[model samples]
Target chain A: MDIDLILKAINITVIGYIIVFVVLFLLYLSFYYLAKLLESQAKERCRRAGKNKCAEHDKFSVDSDTTAAIAMALYLHFGETHDIDSTKLTMKRESKRYTPWNSKIYNVIHRL
Target chain B: MEGLYRFLEYTGFANFTFGHGIMIIVGLVFIFLAIKKDYEPLLLVPIGFGIILGNIPFIQNAGLNLGVYENGSVLRYLYFGVLSGVYPPLIFLGIGAMTDFSTLISNPKLMLLGAAAQLGIFATFLGSIFLGFNLNEAGAIGIIGGADGPTAIFLASKLANGSNGNLNLIGPIAIAAYSYMALVPVIQPPIMRLLTTKKERVIRMKPPRSVSKVEKIIFPVAGLLLTGFISPASLPLLGMLFFGNLLKESMVTERLAETARKPMIDIVTILLGLTVGASTQADIFLTKQSVLIFILGALSFMVATAGGILFAKFMNLFLSNENKINPLIGSAGVSAVPDSARVSQLEGLKYDKNNHLLMHAMAPNVAGVIGSAIAAGILMSFLL
Candidate 1:
């Protein structure tokens, strides 16, 4: 039962928890304000351009599947090749072997 | 006959001990659980095989240089990454590349749940001290509560890696952290159910506002500066994480992001898992302290889960009914990533079909990752 060691441990834990919370809280505030600033900036840009539908565009989003599908359609429409295969090809020779049904000798024996 | 006797002395049967037999069975159980139960198979399989490899008894004091602890052994050389605290940062880089911060950026207040869950780490520190562990050992052991394996290993390697008379505890701490992370589905649901009312579990949150591309690009850079300024010791980890995210968000570095998230991460994970598993030699790993670490780890998880769940409920008092959060997602604040998030979704489905909480849960889940890294930095500053 070391009292000094216990005191040190308690001090560290309290201070550690406070620091973690403060740092995260600060992060939260920064992000909250950043989001607000970005929103206002977008609004200003929309007003200057004389467009009423800027918020509408911001609200619109495409999921990954739709994006992929659109990309594929564009690729096909443009007639671009996605895959490039090597022009050089190598071939190997194969020897034919006889099966019971295919063999001439077997057919002759059956006829006899 | 004499030559035959000499050969017999070199055999596995001649060198085998009871400890080796127990460890071998433990390895087998890990493999079986991975194959049959589908519990973190990618990590557990490599670790399980490494365990069996390490526990294969060899002749003692023979300069064979075959074991992981032996000088010039291949496994030992690979293990230098873990010992020197290199692998965790690389793992963070991969995580950052793959993770989408849209949910978190759109809903920042959920970050509080992530911060609250860190109560487990501090609570475990106090518990460890009461149990007579020194400050350094207690600090290293406490991070098991983060429910993130790499962070735990990173902290342990720095604080308790058998240097300066500190107990080397990286192996047990890593095993405990990963084990609890894998068991998130089992561990978290019960606590979530216990903490929240049935009505609270079924509450639907407002859909997150779509994050703009510019916001995504700016987030990592801003995050890096904010967190790095607060805890510079965390730069190695936070810097790599933000850099990986920037590579993904920059749109021009897609190839680099793809490589970092896919192949590079996979190779590092294999090396980290195998070396960590092999480091658990029977003589060093099987001890009273190891058992205490496991117990404390489980307690840490429970406390962390409770802390998140309670904090969510506490926040509900301040919000309007439309903005009320489903407390079940609070359990995702422990940083097990999508596993804990999935638990929230599944539990939500049980109460009401078509109630999807996965997206909402992910906000706190990712936040927990950052929060734990920051917590690790704090511990390092104080204890180290």
Candidate 2:
């Protein structure tokens, strides 16, 4: 009930906010640029792989309509069934422990 | 006739008080809400049944001990998880295992929105004091702003305990916090809408950049150092959180992460929920102070949501049109995780279906967890 106590609470709010902001801001600066760098490198790797290999990697902005259309087309053609190991003309890059697909966690989050 | 009278005396029907009946109704209402409304049913179901178990009157400290308050009872052993502060950190461990930090790693700036929302905790701190709670009780009540049940329990366990070792306020505080969490669908959207305009709600944020595995792996380590350096008291909660993330990101520890996220979390949640429910016997729960704490708790959630939204709006002023954040995502900064973020998504969909804010909202939502944990740590340092 004391005015001083209120002031203390207010001060805690202000200072706490500032500290959290600064720490996260520091993370923002570091991680933002790091992500940018990693993205650029990924793009470069995609380019090196050839224009056809990762056409969608650089085009991350594909609209949901396009995605839905693609999905519908696939669904119609495949009739809701597909063989897991159907052979197709494709080349392999070296296997790695962590790709977006294989790490098996993206199933947990909606990327799009 | 004498034996029948003794049996009747031993039966709960003979000993039940009106308070016990009232608490039973409270427990039933919780169960009904869980089943009908599907409001945090995993939590409310166990807790609701536990409340019934708690309020079942029996002879104290006797061989037929069924009361939670009675010594040498099964419920007393379970309640030790709450008293000893074991279940929460383990829950955090599971939360860490299941949590995807990619949203946060993608948009680190959103972390500030999480921090900004902790205003609710301090705001409620003062509110509780003015409403006549002492310093310790005020701190316990204020943490309801975290919208996080475990942190609230941890803080209440430490702060609200009297010199005589009485933990009088933990029950109401936990219930209030979880109730607000379940009501995220109700409590957050209005504050979010009131604080932001339609245009702001409809604004689309760019999809977060795809994160790399190495970065994801390193994040928990760096985050641990940064937050731990700031608040050592938060280390137990934060440590388990980061440790679980490490197991998840390490990839070699997939089995461990799966175990932590699934079975470990489920077990801890069951114990934590049941004990918390049982702890809410009407004698401890129906106090005038409990009412005030609930009121302040609701207020804290509102202020936290508004603060996050306003902070997002404030940040938008500095951002270019292309980079502007939807202020609706700001309300997700209350650490209710997928629920508040889901609210943001639903509210955004109400404006423009194309404006999917789920991923963007998740950044601040998870950040809110860290922010609230940090706030809890800071408060513990001050009050305890």
Candidate 3:
């Protein structure tokens, strides 16, 4: 009913709205940085663990595609199934070609 | 026919009213949400049952009281515990024990976001005032923006009634705040997606460095001192919160921490929920103003989310890194605990599977609890 009062309300609401945006922005930035740090650390850990020439070459070629497939399978079967022992058995049966290094990678993915 | 009429009269079946019927249904819905939906079940179930009991007609004098007095009812007695602000803060002591401040200490910058998210409270406060609510009423209403039920109750009890007074706004406010909080997953995502693109959402974050034990111990104590200096009214809440955190970090009192986190929080939640629900009788709840309270409460949540997202966009100006933040986590700054953080994680995962935003978002999520309490205390001091 009062134009000045309505305008003031709008102003306050706008300011309040802006404040929320700023906070979210900061949180996003913090998470983004945190994730990058974790990824780098994981990569470094992988590099250090794979000091041998054979392991280093395999690690590089594992590729994003293989990682995705492994991740999907692990999450769908292992995570959703909720039977860790059974999932491990299934993984061993399905991926008989899995190396000790592959198991290590699986462990890392499962942790995530 | 005469016998049938006498039976009906004795049974009081003819005395049932529309209000009683409506309240019964409302109580049933609360029960359903509590039991079936598992929505804050510990509190909601008792509160729901209490509401049903309070609303049943002709049951007011069922030998429940010593004598009929002008202001005494079984519901009123239970409601007084809520009105006096007794249950909510004691509940906070338990919450303090349950909460781990390490997430916050590991990432202190998120505290700013927590503070930023509280724009919702102040905005809603001013909005309620314009909506023709007096300062105390506006403060009570605005706390819904904080999205913390205990803080809302504490502030409402203080502002609406100092030592002993009857102000009927706390029930609706608490209900609205908790309801919205539970709905964080439903409420936060669309806003987050609309504001940020896939590029931003997929932005990878570096994992936090391990925080030193010294930093963890100093954090809660320093936080209390700093926040208390700024707003003394916030000391009780901030003090309890930091104390709980200190107990967890100190690691010497595992038993005390366990007590604070589990049975203690559980017991208080039941009492608080029932007391709140019992306070919401049909006579009080069936008002146009109550409906408006819910609407305003939702608006507050939306505004709070928007504020966080926009602020993130603004921050983009100062920094240049490959890992820009996904603004969605800003919504976690509203004190819903882990729910809003979970929502942020889900949204981030949608863009990039590797984006584990939960632990990171937790920093602001917990900080938002402190921020809202501070804001509430400020409101109480000024208004009361």
Candidate 4:
């Protein structure tokens, strides 16, 4: 192997890994700050919306424990015997419906 | 009798070779895997059928224009999208529209795992070079570790575009990437098991906070600007991805989002898969280099899986016991998307039921997509 080629490959690998980590790390910082800012804004909005509305706003931030509890409650309520629907609506025509235009007597008689 | 003899000369029986027979069986195997095993059927089926279509022996240079490589062929025209790096970004648009970034937004630290898994990409670059491939071919081959078929195809198209007397590796690389991606369930778990302890696998992370609509709307624009500036070479792909995401998040462009994620994506996937598969003509595709590429691809995937798991464990050293993340979710750092995450979920369940890691695993899974594209950009800038 050429010495220059090996060095070039090493250089590319180090630089490539660094750039990927840095870009994603920067995204992490941005999202972290964005979440903080959003949380504060939500708090302020709730403060203006009165105590009742503030309580409702809090529901969106449920902890994992509460979520698990809610899930358990729902599971207990519904059990496992729910109806299975494929959500597909298939129309099966047993036979062609009798229509005035298609009636045998009308066609044969030529009533008009 | 003379006319009949002329007709027989043009028949497939006259034209068939051992290579065609082998390639046809390979095609049938792909179709079987897709239909029976349910392994990325959406891709495998089209590719499988295309392989059969492409390998149907015909007289060479007969002005038939039937082969994918032949000029004026319909398959060749469709292949232009892949060769020119057009189809991957369009597929990215659909991925963006369908993807929900809330999990990532709620917990950003997981993005590092996505970055960590890219170790496989870089590592494979060195490996390919050591194996005697040129810089550009190595770079194209390295992306298979990213476990993202589109990124692999895109980078291979650009870096190994077959210009300047280089080998046209787009077909082999694409097939390798997609094949490994479909086998994520098979490839990742063993590595995941090898790396993590039962206690680590059973660790349950907290549920994500619900993101506000405003934050959701702002993320795509911010993402586009940030990643776009850092790796402009990736803009063609990242730009479309974020644009499709913006259309989805904006709420006003629901119709456009629907179209992007649904019908448009489906059409492009069919074209990309079929053309890519058809590009694997017996004479062009089966080579010693193709075998080497497959080996390197599998090694890269394993390295990527280990990198994610190890990185998660390293992060755990800094985190408090209560805040520790499941190391199995680390495997989701490879850019296979929901599949890697699903593996995490399944593996986690094996250790402890009622511990749903899907939502948490998604953070890294989606970030891996962004990370791989950035890596592709960096490689393109350097190697191209």
Best by DockQ: 4
All candidates: DockQ: 0.31, 0.25, 0.07, 0.47
lDDT of 1 by residue, A17-101 (tens): 8887887788788888889999899888887877767867576765434543675699797886547787999886755444866
Report clash pairs, candidate 4. none
**lDDT digits (tens) for residues A1-112 of candidate 2:** 5888777767776776677677667767878888888877887998899887578786666443454467569979898576676678788886444566555674444354
Name model 3 segments beyond 4 Å from true: A1-112, B1-15, B59-75, B161-167
- Give candidate 4's TM-score: 0.90
Q: State the lDDT of candidate 4 residue by residue for A8-106, as single tens digits.
A: 999999999999999999999999998888888888998988878888877767665576578679989889657986899999877545578679965
Instruction: Give lDDT tens digits, candidate 4, residues B1-384.
Output: 999998898889999999999989988999999999999999999888888888999896898888889889888899999999999999999999999999899999999999999999999999999999999999999999999999999999998878976789998999899989999999999999999988888898977888889888988999999999999999988899999999999999999999999999999999999999999999989998899999999999999999999999999999998779899989999989889999998998898887878888999999999999999999999987
Query: Which candidate's TM-score is highest?
Result: 4
Which scores higher on DockQ, 3 or 4?
4
lDDT of 1: 0.87
lDDT of 2 by residue, B208-245 (tens): 76677989998899889988998888888999999999
Order the candidates by TM-score, highest first.
4, 1, 2, 3
lDDT for B76 (candidate 2): 80
TM per candidate, chain B: 0.98, 0.97, 0.90, 0.99
Candidate 1 runs further than 4 Å off: A58-112
Candidate structures ordered by DockQ, highest first: 4, 1, 2, 3
User: What is candidate 1's DockQ?
Assistant: 0.31
Q: Candidate 2, residue B162: CA error in Å?
A: 4.4
